[model samples]
Target: MQGFEWHVPADQLHWKRLQKALPSLRDIGVDRMWIPPGCKGMDASGIGYDVYDLWDLGEFHQKGSRATRWGPKEHLSEMMQTAQDVGIGICWDTILNHKAGADRTETFQATKVNPEDRNAAISPPENISGWVRFDFSGRKGKYSSMKYHHQHFNGVDWNETRKETAIYKIAGARKDWAKDVSDEHGNYDYLMFANLDHTNPEVRADIFKWSEWIGTELPISGMRIDAAKHYSAAFQRDFVNHLRRTTFVGNHDTQPGQSLETIIIPFFKPIAYGLILLRSQGQPCVFYGDLYGLRGGPASLSRPACSGKLPILMQARKLYAYGEQRDYFDKRHCIGFVRYGTVHYSWGLACVISNTVATYKRMYVGVKHMGEEWTDILDWCIETVIIDHRGYGIFPVAAKSISVWVNDKAKGRKSLARPFDTDIYDL
Candidate 1:
């Protein structure tokens, strides 16, 4: 039954502005802020993914990340500190999946500089820590299908075929990192992405080192495990276990394999963690990406074909996961669920209303079933916490000039549905 959600720029911003808005946001029922990892630009076509300097944010980005001008992580930390003082919980984006090439370009200047030393942290073969591609077919059991292609060059399942040549290209193995794993037809010996191999002990070590540093130093109150769907469910448990045990006291597991192998890694349920932790000492807010409906009934917000999963991992959410406050199907904007303490009310008797792209379509269908072209405001108040703004006021468009009314109430909140204002529940 918590209220609104806000996504703050993880980059630098006027701390004073955020400070000033704190009281207002609090008044508006925004309990948490999911901060971004970086402020880098990302073009949908070229970028199945985007890059950011995780450790080195010398300054803050002024514009949209998909738009440029990234800042230092310190700036974000400062804002987070302020948020804590204001009784707002902070959720930091855990961008552990991949990193930008810029940071690894110099490779290993921090280590002893020796041209012949291949073991250097920044060696040609060691482009980045934990970002190495896998040769699962050779030394270990790996599944290329597991990598999240949205961050890759082509954004498809190359791992299923396991073409060594294709693997080389995806790993960005150019001048020095190249190997003789390819054949004449340009097929891969093993298909894989530039993802960090969890099986590699050294890779695991680096991940922990960084995790401890950020968790302890930055006062990271919460986490949003990025690309959760791609990683092994068991590995997710191990990662979180390590995350939970973070003492912030020099945690670096150098033993390349089996730090805590006995424990069976649980399914990578990011939201499930929230379900458990929110009731316990762990942070309460975690986002579930449209997979709810597929598992339960209907109430997801993604296109199955869009993600390329064999079967759609999305749903057409009709009911929310709330306990007795359920809105009669047609009265709700969109359904959002929570597995709060001891409750699995999938019937969605409770609701939260917001004007989001994901919810509107489902809401529209519900509205159509109820014989209405649009919805009212009070209905939204019961369903989602309405926000008047969006990223600098620009709405998320289906295409150019096809605006979405995610943030219509805010004076400056932008909408992608420009030139043709669609009905966006103006109650």
Candidate 2:
């Protein structure tokens, strides 16, 4: 699911609604589900990305009671379990870069640096009031009693006493800035608020302990690591590899012209969704907004579900697309690929997607089924193609469309069985 869209006041009760939709999500061929950040944030209303307490997964009263805008701890757990029971892997979004909602402030020495060039020192190191301490007074040390101090952080943006926004590297910090971070704004390590120092052994140990603790407490299959480019690449590599988690590509941080508006531009659905589902590399994630044509406006705020081509694309992914892949991303406007099926599977799929206009492309499907016929499963093209002796066929695709041509042999097979569900979404 897309989780919360921009500026949507997603309440803690949303997970209860999701618990009811677990079976529906499985029916729609969601093998994995990406949930929003589960930790407590600056406020109950804010998304979990504004992380305040790592140990609080809607279980502490720190952020205006025991909830993190996705429902209470019990509701979140039940939803995860429900998804797991239906064979869906739960992918949790993790924020490890910066922290917010500090409980109190303290005096600390820091070096003032130029925002334009983080490495360039503008002022000599001096004592300044900083907001890097977190005690999590509400939780009462339920999960962890580890209170974060200014030493656990490398730098912060706002100067507490001056009430100003400027990047200040904490004094006695081992590293000036995190290495191998994004070059945006000179160094992207100090994103906002208290920047976690991955180099700090104590900080790293605390993170390790929290990661293990959460896994033992919750059912999580993978993680969506946030602000990955804002930390040490080596640290991230080690952490993800140690956890054995499946990582994805998308995140909230984007360039100047890369807003959600630009992403949802005209005719963007087919191309984006096609590339995601049709590829065999990483597991694809379908955004609920794109699935329901949810344009960013007042009317789209409550769009739970809507009829769209995503259902068909998901069905195609689950049923036919599999095995070894070949990419035909040679052209500018059109891209296509073929999936050679496994032995137990009856069908393989050849996909051709284009953004500009309709065109025909001759591609090889493999020599095993020389004379076999293939039909477009998505109906983007109705005409069938018969593979020649060379396993080559001319496939025509519609303009601004994603076409999936499945082997004729599997076209008549029964649709994949949906997991037995009670249809609780209506509740």
Q: Which has the greatest TM-score?
A: 2
TM-score of each: 0.38, 0.83
| Residue 326 in candidate 1, Cα distance off native in Å | 6.7
Model 2 clashing-pair count:
1
Model 2 per-residue lDDT tens digits across residues 1-427 = 5543444346567687667766766766678777788899997888777899999988778867788787888998898889879988877889999899898898888989989888888999888888888989988888787889998898988888999888999888366687688988788778778999988888888887788787888888777888788898988987876565533222332211225434344456555666777678776777644443333354642342212556666777777777889888899988889888778764778888787899977899888779988887666688999999998988889887777887766853235323223232244
Off by over 4 Å in 2: 1-4, 173-175, 241-261, 292-307, 324-335, 361-374, 382-394, 407-427
lDDT string, candidate 1, 201-232, tens digits: 55456567667766766665677676655444
lDDT of 2 at 263: 36
